[model samples]
Target: MSISATEGVGPSLWGLGATTSAKTQQDKDMFLQLLVAQLRYQDPMNPTDSSQFLAQSAQFTSLEKMEEVAAQTAAMVQAQLAFGASSLVGTTVTYATGPAGDDGSPAPTATGVVDGVTFGSQGPVLSIDGTDVALAALHTVTRPGIGPDAGTAAATPADD
Candidate 1:
């Protein structure tokens, strides 16, 4: 069935008036519907300017491309975090821990080999010596023999 914009029927079919703002895909579709209806029912003697229609179409295309770029940037950030974490595997990392004394004091450090990496709500977390350490918590990365117990022989957990 044909529709007319001036009959109040177009708003009901589109769920939103053409004059309303659109922020999402559904809203964009409704906006497009309203625009189409307006074009179809516009006064034939005073038709909309072709340039105006072209401008609106250009704006919509720009908005769509911006959304695509945002999505791709987010994916790229996640991939970078994953790659950085993965590279830490088998390497010893030292991270800050609480004070060595009961009273507030200088922070101590713990060292361990990264066993695995996993994503958490905040960001990537590294599995170090059976403990999950946030990436931000790491203070330094060094060879296995360079930390606090550099010369002490310790049993490897994997050997147990």
Candidate 2:
């Protein structure tokens, strides 16, 4: 009988240890444990290379650093969006309403004062005339005094 790597052999106890499903820090610890076990139980006649262990450790470190950078970048972008959206308060904006179908018809637009800015799961959403409009739905944004029709005053502060 031939035993394979997946057969829970000494090293298989750790598995490949790389998976998208294992997102938590505990998963990383388990993977590290597997690596250490593999090194400890390696055949004495053909010991594992120190350089290989170093490379794997470096790779894991790099992955962690990259994930941190990505998280920071996402936070920065969200901050920028919040700042930009807040500036829209008291300003007039024309935004598309409802889904735009494939009929090539002109999308209906509504103009109102930006009551407040809120964050949704996807990104920034604006409160326009008591409606939640996505930032992407905006067609135009104009200062209150610059346009022929000034923006309507916001009725009240937005709900949390």
Candidate 3:
């Protein structure tokens, strides 16, 4: 009789944890538990191959490193968003008011200089003329004193 390393493990092993850091720790713990159980219950007459164990260990290490890189990348992206939002503090921005009218009219828009930025779970919200506007709603950014055509900077949506 033989039991594979992943004989009973299923899709539940890939379920997400509460946070990136917490998820990584949880994954390591679960992997270790499975490895220990495999070692303890193996048939003595047909011992599991040592090379198989080594391969599993190497795969676990690779997964851990990949998780660390993902966490670092998320942090870097957040920092970039903060810096970009801050740079817009004094620039005029034209933003959509809402969806287009049901009568086929274009969507209403409002323009204002961004006065402040507030970070939330959804990303940065710009305070434009005292109104809170999502970064995605912005259409164009223009320097305060420049003409509309010459100063218009294309708006880019933030990644969700």
Q: 1-160, model 2: which lDDT tens digit per residue?
A: 9643334533234333343234545556666778867976899999999999999989877876676677679889999998999899988899999777689877888999999988888888999989999999999999856766756676897899
Model 1 TM-score, all chains together: 0.62
Weakest lDDT window of 10 consecutive positions for candidate 3: 8-17
lDDT of 1 by residue, 1-160 (tens): 8545334533365344343434564656666777787788889999999999999889876875676677679879988998998899889899876545768665788989899999877889999999988898899898666767789787877855
After TM-score superposition, the amount by which residue 63's alpha carbon in candidate 3 deviates from its true location, in angstroms, is 0.8
* Pairs in steric clash, model 2: none
Clashing pairs in 3: none
Q: Rank the candidates by lDDT, best first.
A: 3, 2, 1
148: Cα error in model 3, Å: 6.3
- The positional error of residue 134 in candidate 3, measured at the CA in angstroms, is 1.1
Give the lDDT of residue 146 in candidate 3: 81
Sorted on TM-score, highest at the top, how do the candidates line up? 3, 2, 1
How many Å off is the CA of 87 in candidate 2? 0.8
Q: Which whole-number lDDT from 0 to 100 does residue 3 have in model 2?
A: 43
